[model samples]
Every structure is written in C-alpha cells, then in structure tokens.
Target: MPHLVILYTANLNFPTEEGGDMSGLCRALADTMIAQRDETDKPVFPVGGVRVLAYPAAHFAVADGSGDFGFIYLQLRMGRGRSEWVQQRVGAALVASAKECLAVLLTRQAVGVTLQIDVGAEVFDGKLGNLHPLFK
Candidate 1:
C-alpha cells in the first residue's frame, strides 16, 4: 500500500495555540486535501500511522524570536514510482495550506509565501550502487 509522509511546521515565535487551535488548521488543510482527491476510489488521508516530520529554520530564531517553520514532506511512499499528477496535486495543496497557516499564525513579513519541496531521489551522494560495483 502507498504511504504518505506528512510534516507539519510552524514558527517558533508564532503564537502557540493554547487549546489545540493549531490542530484545527492542520485538520482543515488535510480535510481540504482529502476533499480534492478522487473520491471515486479510496481515502487519500491516512487513517492512522501517518509519518510526520518537522523542519525549523534558524532564521525563525531571530531577534523577535520568530522561528521559520515548515514541513519536510507529505509525499507518497510506495514501491511504484510516484505519479507526476499525484505529486503535483498534493504538493500544490500542501504549499498553499502551509503558507496560509503561517500567515494566520504570524505576520506577513514573518511568514514566507514561498515553499520549497524536494525529494531524496533528486540528490545523489556520488556513491556507486551494487549495479555499478563491477564497473567501479
């Protein structure tokens, strides 16, 4: 089965919700995403055991104490290569939601409008794999 890795981020100084307010925002975004998926089939959002990561930028620790927060990824983890359309759709939705969530949590200047999403496959360590052992 295909799995999803979700990362939820927020500014350190970005006012923390006292009564689980932030959770609501996350749910809203997730719900929005689930709604956009093809309902004719299966559920997009994970029912349980969802992988989540948090990325905190050093810049967010500036004088005002605003931590630049972001999610590492919310990508599909499957044996089969992820489909372009699926990645694009999910990425777009996540980015939009993150930016909106940040804006609501912090000031416009503090919340960056741009989001950068990358996959491990996009980078290499210059190490040869078993297939290239003989060649090396």
Candidate 2:
C-alpha cells in the first residue's frame, strides 16, 4: 500500500483563482506511481493501492516574508519490503510529476518542493479497503 500526502502553503496561489488545483496534482502523482515499472517492465506498484491527499497550510511563515514564498511538502507512506531501487524510482517519478503539476505556481512565485518516503511498520499498519475493482 502507498499513500501520498501533500502539504502546501495556502498562499501558493490566489484564493479566488482556483488555488493551484490540488485535486489535479493529487491525480497526477497517483497516476505516476501507478505507472511505475521494474527492470523487467512489470508494474512496480499496485495501481489499486495508490492514494493521494492534499492539504493547504492555513498559517505559515516563509524565511523571506515576502508572501511570495511557497512550499510543497510530500510524504509518502508505504508497507515495507520494497528494494531501494524501487523506492528511488517511485520518489523520482513523484517529484517530476509534482513539478509538472505545480509548474505555473513555481514560475509565478518562489517555491520549495520536497519529497520524503516512509516505510510503515508492518506489525502496526492495517488496511481494510477494496480498490482492486478500479484497477481491474
């Protein structure tokens, strides 16, 4: 299972101007993960297991205080047992996808984007959902 969470500054875009399309960004990220493949060209991640969510920070402070500064932090959580290569592939793909999604915002303002991947403890993690139907 893989879950992607994106947290971004609220000022990244004008509130009245659609606010940078978080939903579309999430979709792009999830799609990128679902499309990853291994050396043999087999799918690396389960398409049904991808989930993406985005949150806007209501209050925050940037180093310059120009209000033109923005940040997008991505946290990816997944079950353990994947190789380092796989993780790198997924991370790289996600960062590229995120950049494309936020291209306009980045060009208009100073933005910092970061991505982190967390391997969840198998003993503590639990899942009870069915998204296989969509993948089928």
TM-score, every prediction: 0.44, 0.86
lDDT of each: 0.45, 0.83
Candidate 2 on 38-65: residue-level lDDT in tens? 7778887788888898899999987779
Model 1 C-alpha lDDT per residue in residues 94-130, reported as the tens digit of each score? 6777666656455523432433434345333343334
- Runs in model 2 deviating more than 4 A are 14-20, 133-136
> How many Å off is the CA of 55 in candidate 1?
5.4
Give the clashing pairs for model 2: none
Q: Which pairs of residues collide in candidate 1?
A: 60-66, 60-67, 60-68
Would you give me the overall lDDT of model 2?
A: 0.83
Candidate 1, 94: how far from true, in Å? 0.6
